[model samples]
Target: KAEVDTSALQNEAIQLSSASGHADVVKLLLKNPRVDPSEKHNFAIRRASMKGYVEVVKILLDDERVDPSVLNNNAILLASRYGHAEVVKILLTDSRVDPSADNNEAMLWAVENDHSGVLKVLLGDSRVDPSEQNNYAIRRASELGYVECVKMLLQNSRVDPSCRSNNAIKHASENGHVEIVKILLNDPRVDPSACTNYAIRHASENGHVKVVKILLQDSRVDPSVRDNYALRHASKNGHADVVKILLEDSRVD
Candidate 1:
């Protein structure tokens, strides 16, 4: 009878977790020796964590059996993806939790969602590398014109402003993020002219006047160094404004 009762309570707790994400029910079930807090049920505490239920998370985390570093669970990744700032905070503070886990997936999630607040928290921890490669966090944030995130990433001395990527300056210029373009331009290490003709032509053709102006003013930029392909593209696309700017400069014509 006791075993059946315990199973019933555990089942009820799971249902409650699924619907309400309440900590009280989770705690009650956890108190039963037969109830497995870490059970892989659909409505487990881990899922609650992903849903941003801080109270339920605290209850689950208190159990010695719960692994704070677990990843890829719908709950954990969802929490990160949705910008559950508080849950992320609690997880990171755990001694057993790995801040750099999942290839810094949490950071990428925060950036993709444009969660500036959560990003600030993650950035404050030195263990989180702002310059990690190929993740949408850095590139997407720059593309989306999240200036604060860009600044935070730039603050890391190890972050290479000129990190070569198809989307780097091209995206920034096309989006009319003048400040980001300016920041990239000022970085001595960034090769503003590295991308293919499409990127340059796009920047030029869009009449991103300020971007063109900045690029032209840079002494390092070879106004005459035309990648034949890009020049033809600019002309073919009928970006007359860009062509005019290019032609106005004696070096380009």
Candidate 2:
């Protein structure tokens, strides 16, 4: 019974030390052959990854028995989600680690949460597919105003600024991300009026006066498209500034 209790404590001990960056303690605990990381689903490595404990992660990865890709690459996901570039890099070096694990969720979290560094590292890995979900990374980054992240993803040949239906510019314009909108426009592939003028309507309805003006400036965007949807929404949403801009457009009746 005593041995059974000690075995249980081993997993907990490693988890605590790994999470706290106690690299030395983790090493000592691992010396005991009974400390099986897989017992708790390799959570200790994940904790270290999430905390950006470079040394702790390296120590754990060095152990041949440790599997960093367990639980659908949860370790890399946590590291990428938390913007731990160093931890992600170390984990990638492990032969068993798949950077594209869990359908490339690690990169998605890094992109969505504005972790450009981690995203960059993940992008460098050929295993990562930036365009896996129809250019999801670029669109989300544009919408969230993550300019740097958007730029990085845009440079990736696989990513399209304007995918089949959903577009990065459309999302950016809707949320008044001026910088991102401009960046997307610079990409010739992006059609500002991709979604039946919904981009302009969303901007107008949300009272994004600056974004509305930017859309109108683009000759390709039909201010009066969708039966004058942009003007109608602006009026209904009580966006006087946006309404004024729309009225100035010759196309808006």
> What is each predicted model's overall lDDT from 0 to 1?
0.67, 0.87
Per-model TM-score, in order, reads 0.77, 0.90
**21-138 in candidate 1: lDDT tens per residue?**
7667777777778766655443465577667888887777787877655544445455677778888788766777655566777777787887777787777777777777753555
> Candidate 1 at 182: error in angstroms?
1.8
Give lDDT tens digits, candidate 2, residues 1-253: 4354424775787888888999999888888887875557888898899999999999988888788988888999999999999999999888788989888999999998999999999999999999988778887898899999998998889998888565678778888998898788888888888778778889998999988888888888898988888899889989999999999988899
Give one clash count per candidate, in the order shown.
Answer: 0, 0
- Candidate 1 residue 113 C-alpha distance from true site, Å: 2.8
Models, CA RMSD each: 3.7, 2.5
Stretches > 4 Å off in candidate 1: 1-12, 15-19, 27-34, 41-43, 71-76, 134-137, 165-167, 174-176, 195-199, 227-232
